[model samples]
Target chain A: MADIVTTANLQEPDAFYADLVAAHDGLSKDESDAYNARLILLMANQIGDHVILKKLLQEAQRTSRKA
Target chain B: MTKLFEAPLYPYKRCADQGAGKPVRHPVIVIGAGPVGLAMAIDLAQADIPVVVLDDNEKVSTGSRAICFSKRTLEILDRLGCGDEMVRKGVVWNAGRVFFGDRQVYDFNLLPEEGHKRPAFINLQQYYCELYLVERIRALQVAGKPVELRGGNKVVGLERRDDHTALTVRTMEGDYDLEADWLIACDGAGSPARRMLGLEFQGRVFEDNFLIADVIMKADFPTERWFWFDPPFNRDQSALLHKQPDGVWRIDLQLGWHIDKEEEKKPENVIPRLKQMLGEGVDFDLEWVSVYSFQCCRMEKFRHGRVIFAGDSAHQVSPFGARGANSGFQDVDNLGWKLKLILSGKAPETLIESYDFERERAADENILQSTRSTDFITPKSEISRIFRDAVLDLSEHHAFARPMVNSGRLSVPATYDGSPLNGPDASGLPARTRPGSPPVDAPINGTWLLDAMGHDFMLLGLGIEVPPLTELLGLPVKGITLSGEEIGPDLRTRYLGEAGEAVYLIRPDQHVAARWRKLDWTEITGALSVALGREGEI
Candidate 1:
């Protein structure tokens, strides 16, 4: 079984956040949600390891609206 | 000190045409002697076409209006024989600092590259631009070029004849009738000629006012554009500060949609606001003050029969991006060559449609850019302001957000990407100097490449052998060759790219008509025909 390395691993956190936000400019609520959905499918293709990909999806799903 | 702009540069004098009982048809008559009109006349006159300029006023424009001129404008003026003088009198600046609510965000340099002849932008008063152009006209007249400037000559009525445009000139003497084979209306924003012709502008109007205050001050502020959004002094409004020549600083503060124009413009109210923005200790004397609203609009078409419109007569934009006058210079540049070619019978009358096609595209580009910048500066809705503030907030910390912040998108010449005149753009050449784009200036041999071209068709061969062809297809096309040491990094990167050798067909207006990897005679003639508005005629 493979493990997902998820210990605050962004080299440029502020830069990434700004890019994420900037890409959503002029987009409505539904458009932004659809864009995120598309982004997920694209990212899944890059991390093609099945076990790590499953672990990442479970981790993201475990986080509810509260956190 | 008395200024050049204060005295009458081209005072009115009664002309033979005004009093000659029977109207004599001129080759070209330009209405309004403002920057656009003067430059238009000079261009036509340089092409050996006699042009007469008529104006309602005898003096240069009063205030420092349209102060920011781009490098493209300078290059165009250089073609008109007065670029060096304008650059000498103007304050050159390229860097701008942006602040969000009193905290400094990021600064930007407009041109970070070298080997270019002119700077990115210059803050010169509009009056000086008019003065320089009028001086050039005087010199052209001395040398006996067919150019005339008749000031205090107002054009009130315009009528289109079967083959020419007739006009009524109203002066102190009396009303006189005149005619023109080609009439150019550069009357200004409130163009009487456009009104007479029943043309109108179509675009959006922003609900905001700006208080422009030009003051003479000795301050420590560097000569850079400084813009603040929602600053403490102007709470919820934006303010801009720029330094000009001779210790003159221009300041503009945004006022909300609903406000009394008269009440806000009073000296007592204006000074206190200045004090708040620039601490109470700064000593400054007001030079010029005015209030204006921003509008981004243009006419449906620029060319109308024998009568054509240029500059403010055809379009007007918010003064945010300096697109107003810079684009006006471009209009003159694009129209002058086409008119000269048409008048000389080198190209057909259909070539005028290409002018309308290309410049109309350019005007759309300017309007689109100006409108975008205006929306970013002045948010129209609640959600818009929130998003703007959020971007400003993130811009300070993240380098990626810096490019997203919009103070103003400064003017650059438009490339007619899909223009009707653009011919075959061979692959593997530099994209910057592709077909329908203006030639990028680079140091070639000992002088600038732009200084060597223009005035006629040119075949530029870089790192390739060019046959000496004086005329091709009965049109004057001069071929010049450069190779070896002449193809430096700057020139190679701009013109050759990785192709190692390229030949370009340059229009009289210094735009690339077509480009190829090597000089092939068949391709050359085909491209030249297409460039002259004769498609597949070869």
Candidate 2:
């Protein structure tokens, strides 16, 4: 298990949310789901540590289920 | 005051042998007197073949167009005998800074670790490059080499016959008949030759306009590239500033798709834009201004019978990455040697087809890169703009996303990896200077390896002494020994590491045609024949 490190994260949270929403501007529900899957894989590759990535993935899945 | 280069018009001489009675056949006739045509003429003349050049305009380019000369372009120009002058007269730069709204995001140095000669990029006006080439041509002429320049001679009609290419050239005096063994069309993007032949220029046109201005001011701006995406002054638009020689700065501002062209180019409209960018009290003289749209297009094939197209005549790309002229120089570099070999009866005419194959690959690459840079610079949709800006923002803090910021992916030489001219790579060898790759510069004794070779087929011996009697199937091959002290350890690691006595058969354009672990005559001759289009699998 790994702890999530957060420092100076999302200073402009509104702008980041705007960008995140705008990324799926024209995509349908299926396409947006596919886009999110692909984005997760891309970010996983960037975050090469498997233990940390798995922890982050579990946290994200937990938070998303609550939402 | 800025120094401006004036193009000296060469006197048109009427050859008595080429009078109006009958058409006289020339060995080679290069259409257009721009960089590509002049470079081709110089290469042919240097190879001891007589060449004549024809151009409609009596001078160099009207303005400072195509300012970025890459290292590969400089290397090719060095072969043409005018590189030192261009380097001396140009401003060399390698570091580039990218900005997003006034704050600097990231910066990159192209050649951070350098041992070789020539910088990554040199910012010189195109007119000065042409002038240096013209001076070299004149020097070759003074030395009694046959290189004829016919300025104000426009090629109107072109007929590609099976035997040769016949041309109806239009001169100020009158129209004259001329024929050539090979006719090279370098008449630029709006090529009349390509249009006359009904060749289709096909590709994507970026729907954005750029206002390019050359302003002469003695400012203390460093010789580094500055690119901004949505700067404070420009406000949500991309802008680029590059320093050129003679106290001139090239400023490119993205002026979306729709705008009055004449209105955007006026001094009144242009001056306010300059004042906003360069602050107040900066007395600057406007050298030139032009509004241009981006297009990446090319002909289906570069070779058409005896008529071959080179440079912008064959392909055109956006000016973002400086691919338009640098790639044109590569075209000339690739074509010059092959054409000379064909004309001198050393190789078969089929060898010229490789030029079409290789240069089309290069053009496709340039078009792809320029299109990506253009797309990144001026994104089409709102989502794209969001991603681009986000990438820039992330690049400011994160090192991982820094590579996403594309401010004109600068030009580099294209390696012909899958070229038919390449032979199999030996086992346990480094892959930097492999077959189809350009020769990596290494100092041997006193002179550089590139300056030493390129006259003919050269057999470079690495890590071992070269043997004599180097006649490869009745073709003379010059053998040179490399001790690998010039480029230091990099050369040893790249060229010769445990591969005892490696031999490379280099082409006339200084590209590695084939390489072998041992000096085998049969393998050498087989690869050489394939390279010359003689026989075997190509």
Candidate 3:
């Protein structure tokens, strides 16, 4: 079995963040919100295992106040 | 829609006349001459193995059944030596549009990557595909290795023996018995061979039915696939429209299971639906109409001693994903070289078992995707419908949720990731074209990579020279070297993205058996032996 690498193990985090923001560069506020929702769903589908997805979701929620 | 290509029935010859009044035993007898059976025969005949194909029907399929051919399937067909013609004659498209009611939800393009030879999908009538295959078989006949296709011939009985299987065939003139070292059942969903063997197919069946109609019209619709959930023409139900070759349009509409198939198939009923969809004044002629409910299922074991199953005989899937026939072509591709190797005594009988393993894994994947597509298309419960609509609504404004919208995953070739035949991937190697994965298409000096690879064990070196050919002599392997600049950068990214001296050992079916950053002669030999079903597995 392969290791359970989290998104925290991502390389070039700043580049990914820049790209994420650049994706909604031309969109309106509502469009940007919708885009984020869509991105979350797509990522969840790719990470199909329920256990891993739940852990990621909980981690994001736990760090929500910091952001 | 006009029956453009009609199949000519070949007269059956007496099997007993071949060898001094004794029935001439064939190496392999394939029952049924549809795409699957014909493909099996052609593949075997190309390998210099004599094959006999028997079909009860004299003509190609009457309807535009199994219309969509995937890129992977086209590659396999190319290897079989008849893909270019099919592509020339078929309607090619890579982009697809999905609609939620009257609003367009999302559109997707499958071939975002460039430099590939074939498109994402091609829509051709099943008859034309069969006709092309039959033409190919005839060409093989002229070349001395003839794949004898006997029309108006039926296998009435089959008895499996310790060493071989005996088939009792009935023809128009008389009945004859022939022996075969192996039997392949490509007899389709209602396989008579499967029935004769009393094999039980087990799996899930979607309760909804779909109405498919092929109409001839000079419509201005593009050759892209258009699918709608709760289409305006058919309220609260799904509909699909695809362009086929020869100005034919394939329209599939979801129908309730309780609807009477015969009543719904009537010209009055069908015409009204067409009127609603295509507008009343449009001139069109209905060529064919079919009402069907698909079942996602397969036989427990594809290999039953000397008698094996391929295509619909081995498994069935909902037509949602266009998986039924495309996966069938993959089965032909997977089984062809393995069977040839086994017949030539180059591989063990255990090699055939890998076909059972890899193809069943493919079947399960197809079934899973098709089932999910069916569920999303025809939501069962109120909650299911709510979730479906939510995803559909979200897709209209959001790019991320678009992938969640499952109309049909569209057929992709299966990868045998966990198979014993797969060797370990180099630690820092890119994962896309790793062991068990099929190699992506790229151009190497104007020729397609797959075309250059041929149907043999390939040792491909990217930006590095492969080991001397003499070192790997006697094995069925070919070595080729390519600089990253010779092929496009995409080829380098797909094959040698890490920018190092990389070597890959690819199987006859185009699946990568093993790879390493540097050539290891011992490792290549070991992986090649395992791939041939010789001894130690990687």
Candidate 4:
């Protein structure tokens, strides 16, 4: 019964991304990939809903390139 | 092997039953002299019920199996009269630290609110637990209580009669037959009694091997539980470090789904893992090494005609949450008093059905939480693993995510919310001490509140005056009156809350059976009648 929030929840999203990438600076490709996995997990926790997360996953998959 | 397992404490001795040339019928026969079985025997003996305990092994547990004893279990032990010795010998701890990679994520304090007699948890080895229980039985036997422990008495065959169940127990000398008016199977997961009846133990077997290494070392690790997720020493797996008494540390390392168990168990393979965890320079000796894959499963119904199952024989959970033995102890706690009532002719036989009803709910609850913790600690899917790692990462900074970090949601007694035995509930009382919930501990008269509430159907008249009534419908009900002025603040908050006065009918196991805003004898007798499973008939 708790809901997942959407629509620009974070303030200064660009600033947050800058800090996130800076945290991953000087890391190898594998390390950066692991960081990205951790990032997805954090954001998914913030989302905190299974249906909303699946919807966002589909949306991101639609916009992204083929694997 | 640890030094504790070197000696057989209860070496085989020929019992009078073996020499009688025929089966001797005991009032109650309990299988397995482990903690649960011994506790069961002690409870019955304390109630003046004759009980006989049989076990295949003469010694206590080999290693530090089931090291953590929760406060709820300690309370049950207090009722059985050995909780003080366990607390004196056990390493009492209430704090735990968790880690992500190499960095500490967060630390927690299981402060347990306040006013409790026991701490949140204690880390005593299972051997000491059994030893204390056996010693209590010895004391009871000396006191002329008909509680006997027959070592090396293995139940090889079981047959249910119309009134009593017969058992063929194998000892070193020869096989002997015995009968029990009521039989309790407290054997471990692979219960021979369950097998004799061809009952099925149904549930999931987790796909992972864990190496449990108990090591001896003199280190000041602050007597707390430490858990790690994907540390450098063991990549992509979880690890747990728990302190046991007697300079022993229990280390569990996740070995993934695939490993040669024998090769992994070797000291050459295990010592390096320990070195990496407890820095290379630290000196330690391998006390014991074991590789095990646990299953979260249980029997369909605990009661099978006259042969009822308790402890690991009835149900089993993943060991991570400290639930396997904790819940098994709870099963004994739930069962002992009911058997006492039935055998004494104070309650109907249908009351035994309530045990199945309440304990099945407890088993399902433990199994659910245990399976969830297992999945979180050892995620089967990639996405779930990412979430677990994410929670660990977020827990370092965010307080909201910290509670979500499930490092074995430590064992707490289950509240039987919808139990059939539950009677009326007063509206204004606290939900924590509501009907069907265990009474929380408080402070009273320089002693503990739980110690004051002796094991019986007690009518706790808090901030009120209750009439002096001895027996309700042929069953005993003890009354304790604490006037509104004399009671402490902790008892008021736990039992009364905003209510002016409350009368709680507590079961022998200390679970609340009913409560009311005021004392009324009509309602009390109706509740006492229904609490013993005579609801519709009344």
- DockQ, every prediction: 0.06, 0.08, 0.11, 0.27
TM-scores for chain A, candidates in order?
0.84, 0.74, 0.76, 0.73
TM-score to native of every candidate shown: 0.88, 0.87, 0.87, 0.90
Model 3, runs deviating above 4 Å: A1-52, A56-67, B5-22, B106-111, B205-208, B232-236, B467-473
Poorly placed runs, candidate 2 (over 4 Å)? A1-45, A48-67, B1-7, B11-18, B205-208, B232-236, B484-487, B497-501
What are the iRMS values of all candidates?
A: 9.4, 6.2, 5.3, 2.9
Q: Pairing residues by index, what is the TM-score of model 2?
A: 0.87
- CA shift of B340, model 2, Å: 1.5
Query: Under CAPRI classification, how is model 1 graded?
Result: incorrect
Candidate 3 lDDT over A6-53, as tens digits, reads 548778899999999899999997666656755666677777787887
Per-candidate RMSD, Å: 6.9, 6.3, 6.7, 3.9
Q: Model 1: per-residue lDDT, tens digit, B369-427? A: 87777777877776667667766766677665566577778898999999989989989
Better of 1 and 4 by TM-score: 4
> Which ranking of candidates, highest TM-score first?
4, 1, 3, 2
TM-score of chain B of 4: 0.97
C-alpha displacement of B170 in model 1, angstroms?
A: 0.5
Model 1 stretches with alpha carbons more than 4 Å out: A1-67, B205-207, B536-538
- Native-structure RMSD, model 2: 6.3
Each prediction's total of clashing residue pairs, residues at least 3 apart in sequence or on different chains, is 0, 0, 0, 0
lDDT of 2 by residue, B400-425 (tens): 66767787778888888888767657
Enumerate residue pairs that collide in model 2: none
